[model samples]
Target: MGCSPTRHRSQLSKLDSPSKLDAPCITQERSIETPGVSPNRKLLLAYYANETTMNGKLKGLFEAIFAKEELEVTTIDLSYHNLNVREIYHLQFVLQNFQNLRELKLNNTEITSKDIKRLYSSLELMPMMQVLELQGNAICNEGIKYLTKLFFRTMKSLKVLNLSNNRFGDEGIATLCKGLLSLRCLEELRLNSNNIYSRGLILLSQTLCQIKTLKRLGLAGNPIDFESVRVLVRSIRSNVNLKELDLSRNGLSKQVKYMLPEGQAVIKA
Candidate 1:
């Protein structure tokens, strides 16, 4: 069965000088105002409603919100929105403004390597970003090269990263691991269903032992082999920080589960 797409709610919080106002939660209604709140404070609340079409609706919404002033947004979720070239350009503008953003979700947005290159400078400004989800995009090996720079330079505090189904094979995996070692606060990493094989797993296994903060790893739906699995098991065997390893639907035998460390949990087929 195909997995359902995850919908992420955007969380926007604004902090102004002196007195602090409570941030209103953004839902389907996209309400950004509350009673008894000052007009200035209400103006600070920016809501990005989910848009089915990216033609003029998305652009108009962004212009309406940003026209007042630059919003101090913390989270932005634009998942499941098929963005064209013009829409992606507007997104880059938004990212450029939100320097203090903490979370950004662009799952299944149909972004490519060229788009990633364009957004590189904007992404560099977000030093405090914690979560970045780009699952089901077309960010192949070329995009991974740009991400490697971000991982080494800016995204030191990134905690969760989901890159599943991006088609960044063993070459991309090797390039990604080069920068993954620089992350000091990464906890969860999802790269499942990415057309990876034993070679990619071997490279990733070598890198996994170094990331002491990594807790969960998702490699399911890949065509990994027995020898690489053994290599992976040995590499992370002494890694006490790693808690869960997902290798499900990889055509591995049930006996492969016994190869894991005593305290580690493996989800094998």
Candidate 2:
């Protein structure tokens, strides 16, 4: 469904950062007929960037979508859009509307630790949210760790998480593993281009062996060498839940690709 803007004479109040008692919120009403829901019933928010003219417009659009209190999924990319403090602050208000939100994405944005914390604090209101993507932000190990703690503790229903290209190195990946260990429902995890190596990959593979629900794992565009792949394969050989793995754009040898576990698929080269 296409969006037709109706200019309502709504007040644009200046919002403060969330208080101790306040929660993340939105005031719009959205329906399943929304443009992006799929057969799997996943709410898609990829078109959020192109629909609004500016941040203010985007906020208004979100407000309208959330007021109905029915929106279950949302995806947004805040990259190269001049997202300042006020814009992030407005997002705190926008999220409150998605009490039932299940999927969320904030790819390619210049989010920091503080912004991530803000989002996390709000999502804490919704306990059933599943998939989340935070690719292309500057949230490194510290930020990732912060999210891991919160996600593991609250979002037991979470299934997928994409945290690629966020400057998180091996240490950050390790921190994420700690969270993954506890994610009973998590399925897919994308950790592309965060400066991870064999050690981190091995650690992840080792931990994933214990996670029965995990399915696909993406480790593309990182610095995992042939040796690292060998370690990863060896670590996950005992794991039977993983189905697909992406290791594209890395300089891996063909022999290592064949080393994937039986019934498991690996995408290399």
Candidate 3:
């Protein structure tokens, strides 16, 4: 990664100077999707950018910029933050500028399934979004309902998705897959380390048959067994867009090479 220009870095430093929230966030402009989008839009890299229980300084900065007519924020990443659930939830509402947002990352935020509704409502405001990553949260099946709502709304524009490290079990995974059946635009999916097992694998395998647009699928560090992977292997066999598959740390590792069909060498166990 290259360094930001001196002038911009100087200005951005003042806005997000917490001395401890050393998180780095990147914001790329979607020129084709959102023409005339501001290149100078302020990005909120809320990765615990300070040593406070709550994001007091970050909240203050957000309020200052929100006072303007057109909000300038395009990215809000709260990964590895110390903010409580309420503070994290409140940040969603204060993000008055959503029309220009193209990426949303909230990894390791300690968010639960109950906060999905508020997050979904916030989703409606960002139409140009192309990437949505919510890894390492506490979201369960109940929270997936709100995620499906957002998916139904943004399925047309979303191209990249990551929901790994959540508590979405078989039922939850199946529900999510049901909603993603028509997400033809999606190209990458990450579901590693989410406690998925045979049932979840079966449901995902069924759904994978219908999703032919995904190029990368990550299911590493799960509880998948030989029987669980049989259907998934078959489903992926017919997929033309799939280029990489990560199945390491799962139960299928020992027999993975023998289980997969001939000439299919992209999978990693």
Candidate 4:
């Protein structure tokens, strides 16, 4: 991601403009590798972001991208980047230019409450967005406020959302269920490893009943009990549309397997 100092530096000598002073000060170009993909590729994506900084040439890289006459970018995935709040905030500058974006993935980016709010605010720029992946972030109960708000706002356009591995606990799952209950079009939800307890399952069961469009639910690796399993099955009895409900690692009793909808449920091994 090294930029030719002579050309790029000259083009962005005054990268700090007064108009952008009010925007959140996010970090880009922290010592890291380039987000290089094919120029003709429609997706600008990255993986293993947890190992190194996703920042490289902030001004130069995107400047070149925007300078092109034909814009092919539709999806931007920066999963496992281990980004800080400021680093996440700084992405608004680049995202603003990618108005036609359809999917955005920020899994394992160390996102917190304030960072999520900043990310949510940037959604206004992505009107066509359909899929949002925020798995493995640090967003706990308090951090879900922005996400809930995001769900409310994007009900029409958002279809698939993954929030796995965030450890939201029982309280956080309850809060998250509030948002899930209102989604009219969301089809897939991944909430694996979120410290879910009986209370969370109860709330989640109710949410499943409410959201008629939800088809796939990833409920693996939680702390669910036998009673909760029965409650969950009963709550979603009317949801014949449910295609798959994965409860792989929850350590539920063997008897619970009979309670689930025979063909649709995937119980523990």
lDDT for each residue of candidate 4 in 107-195, tens digit (9 for 90 to 100): 86666666666766677566577788889776777677667776776545677888888787788888888887656778888988888
TM-score of each: 0.77, 0.73, 0.75, 0.73
Model 3, residue 112: displacement in angstroms? 0.6
lDDT of 4 at 48: 21
The models' CA-based lDDT, in order, is: 0.74, 0.66, 0.67, 0.65
Regarding lDDT, does 2 or 3 come out ahead?
3
lDDT value for model 1:
0.74
lDDT by residue (tens digit), candidate 3, 90-205? 56644444566777777876677766656666677776777888898777787877777767776457778888988576777888887787576888889998878899999899
- Across 64-89, the per-residue lDDT of candidate 1 in tens digits comes to 45444433467777777666565676
Task: State each candidate's clash count.
Answer: 0, 16, 1, 7
Comparing 1 with 3 on TM-score, the higher-scoring candidate is 1
Worst 10 residues of 3 by lDDT: 1-10
Off by over 4 Å in 2: 1-57, 62-82
Q: After superposition, how far is residue 156 of candidate 1 from its true place, in Å?
A: 0.9
Candidate 3 regions exceeding 4 Å error are: 1-57, 60-72, 258-265
